[model samples]
Target: PALHRQRHQFVIDFVKQHKPKKVVDLGCSECSLLKKLRFHREIELLVGLDVNGAKVKKHMYGLAPISTDYLQPTYDQLCIELYQGSVTQEDARLRGFDLVTAIELIEHLTLADVGLFSAVLFGYMTPVAVIVSTPNSEFNPLLPGLRGFRHSDHKFEWTRAEFRSWALKVCLDYGYEVAFTGVGQAPQGQQESVGFCSQIGVFHRIGGRNGCNMLLDDDADDVFSYTLLYSIKY
Candidate 1:
C-alpha cells in the first residue's frame, strides 16, 4: 500500500501552497511518491535516498510498467534521482529539496537517533518544510516491552506529544520555528471513531526563504469530530 496515497490531499495542498522545486522522499522504498508527481514536470528535481541503493535500481525496472500508466515518460526522463542511503547518515547537502517526507519511517529509528536524524536532515538540506508521520505511541500495542511497531527493526514508537516535542526541540536548536499538524484529516468525516483514525504531523520550517507557512490549529480538523482514543496536536 502507498502511504502517499492515504495523504494525497495533504501533498496537493502542500504542493499548491509551497511549490517546492526539489523534493526528497527519505527512506523512499519504491519512489511511489515520485511517480505520483509525474504530471507536475516543472517541479525541477527529485532525489530519493534509502539504505539500499541496489534496491532502488532494481525497482526502477520493475516499476517501469507502473510508470507507463501515469508516471509516463519514465523517471530517467523526468529528472528523478534515486539512491540508497540512510536518512540518519545520508548527505542531504545536494539533496536539499523543498519538501522532505519520512512517513512511517520514524518508528524504525532508535529513540535517541530520531532527533539526531532530523538534525542531520536540516544540517545539510535545510528544506523550507518537512512532513513526518509515525505511529502514535499511544496506540502502539507493542510498546513499553514489545518493542516498537512490532517490527523486528523499529526502535520506538512516539506518542503525539513525544513526536511534537522532538519536532520542536530539533527545529529550535537548528534555528527554525515549527508548526505541526495531523496527516489524515477527519473534519469532513461522517462520524468519530478510534480504530478508523490515523495520526501524522507536518513540520513547517519557518523563515527559511522558501516553502509556504502552513499551519492548522483547528482541533476539530481531524478525521473525526471527537475521538477519545486519538490524541491532540503537539
Candidate 2:
C-alpha cells in the first residue's frame, strides 16, 4: 500500500519536476508508477517493463495484448504501456526520451550484466535524463539467518562509495553528467539498510571533458536524502 502510494506520488512529482516528453520505467512491478502517471496532462508517453509476466498481469488487468516474450506497446501516454521483460537482458530500445527510470532495479541483475545492461539502456537515450536506483551493499540482509541485511533475490548490492565509483564511471563511459545522488528513505527510528541500497540516479548525455573519459562533476550533489538520490546527470 505504501509502496504503491509512494510510487504514485513519485510519478506525479517527477512528471511535474522534469516535464519529460517520454518516460520509461524499467523493472516496473505492476506499473504502479505508470498507472499513477495517468493524471499528467503533459506526458506524451509512458512505458513500463517487468521481468515477470505474472506480476505484470497482476498489476495490469488489461495489458494482455502484450503477448510477446519481451515487449509490445500497449497504449499511448493516456493509456499506460506495460511490458513483461527484464531491464538487464531486454533491449532498451526506448530512444531519445526526456527521461528513463529504473526504480529498485540494478541489484536484481547479476553483477556481470551491470555494464552491458547500462550500455543497452544508455544506447537509446537521446541526450536526456535517466533515473536509476538499487540497494545499498552495506545493509543488505542477505547475510545468513538475517543477521544483517537480507534479500531473497538480490544479486549484488553496492555501498555508497561503491555506488559513487560506479556512478562516476557510468557518467564517463556513457556521456552523462551527474547532477545529484543520495540514499532512499527509511522508517523513523529503524535504521535503514545502507548495505541494501535504495539509490537513485538522474543523468543526461553530454560530450567528454576534452576527449577524456567524462567524470562526474565535482558539483554533483551527494546531499541529504532518504531512499532516493534525485541525482541529475547529463
For each of the candidates, the C-alpha root-mean-square deviation to the true structure, in angstroms, is 12.8, 11.4
TM-score, cand. 2:
0.68
TM-score of each: 0.69, 0.68
Candidate 1 accuracy as TM-score: 0.69
> Which residue pairs show backbone clashes in model 1?
50-85, 137-158, 186-222, 186-223, 187-222
In candidate 2, residue 208 scores what lDDT? 24
Can you write out model 2's per-residue Cα lDDT over 1-234, one digit (the tens) per residue? 454355346546767987876777877776667656644646666667676767766766543323341242453334356666555543333445677877777877887788867776764333377776666655444333654334667776677777778778988776777654444344554444443225556676674223223232433532221122111111
Model 2 deviation from the true structure expressed as Cα RMSD, one decimal place:
11.4
Q: State each model's CA lDDT, in order.
A: 0.58, 0.58
Model 1 per-residue lDDT at 231: 13
